[model samples]
Target: MSVNLYRFGKTVVTIILKPLFRIQTIGTESFPKDGGVLICANHIDNLDPPVVGLTSPRVIHFMAKEELFHVPILKQILPTINVFPVKRGMSDKGALKKGLKLLKEGEVLGLFPEGTRSKTGELGKGLAGAGFFALRTNAAVVPCAIIGPYKPFQKLRVVYGKPIDFSQYREQKISPEEATEVIMDEIRKLISAHK
Candidate 1:
């Protein structure tokens, strides 16, 4: 990964966004300092990734839709900024394996559990992919919620909740769908708390 590029991009984004939007981050102290962590947040706007990444305490490697990589400029820039593509809808084994490897290597992976943006800016149903990674790696799952509209000069908040440990469910016969509910519930609470 291009660490320098990621840092540069973050610096630029921060400079541009700080004035346009009143951004606030809460409960960032809950983020794990070491080891793998999965950051599952509710998707609202297309800019959610960068907005969340900038407010986050850690450098987040995000899983973006595969279509984004199809653009020539984005394909080159996305990777430099620590963004990777994943096929949506079906089970993309390649993407899943890549995410698993990153987690095993103690890297943080950011995913939008809804798999797509919510038009109404409300939290949508969580996808099974996030739960699969959480249960498979037994990494800390940190639930995050991005609140407020994307309008200029509007109040925007990114709330990070306490890390959730799914180790106990590893022993039980828990499906990814069930595990997803556990993660989503935490995110829902964070959103409600800020509203």
Candidate 2:
């Protein structure tokens, strides 16, 4: 039921955004057709989630800040569209469990590793949480980038980087910080490439 509503919402959003923003996408073929996958991207504006989610073919189960869920109407609508809340600035064990469960079920999980949006719209250092989940679940990480202006009628681009597999790194007992640096590097490249 949620999946159906997600699709419907995506279609509706696409229709609205396409004409207004001139949104374009590339490298979608990099997405894994099956198995658990992580979509990690840079967060610039609040519009990033809906833009990326609507543009991608996969139904992205996005981890959003708990505050957004408190909005009067959005609290009821967001869950139906695959948006779930996570407490910020601390480890939320319940959110982690929910994320792992979703990945174990071979679903796609979308996250912004920067932990928060960049006020200047520039890339920021990524938190280790994304790498932690990637290592724990052995999920493929797809680095994503969103570029260009956020205003209406401006061209916006979404680029998906090739999946980075950390299984070898996990086996070698690499530090979470090191692994996160690698993931963030790929995301940085994607953002730079698209710009």
Off by over 4 Å in 1: none
Candidate topping TM-score = 1
Q: What is the C-alpha lDDT profile of model 1 across 1-195, one tens digit per residue? A: 899889889899998886687888899887899899999999999888999889888888999999999998999899888888899889999899999998998999999999999988878899999899988996799999999788899888989999987878788959999999999999999998898
Clashing pairs in 1: none
Off by over 4 Å in 2: none
| Backbone clash tally (model 1) | 0
Per-candidate total of colliding backbone pairs = 0, 0
Candidate 2 local lDDT, 30-143, one digit each (tens): 788888888889999888899999877688898989999999999999889888899998999999999998898988999999999899988899987888888888677898
In order, candidate lDDTs are 0.90, 0.87
Steric clash pairs (candidate 2): none
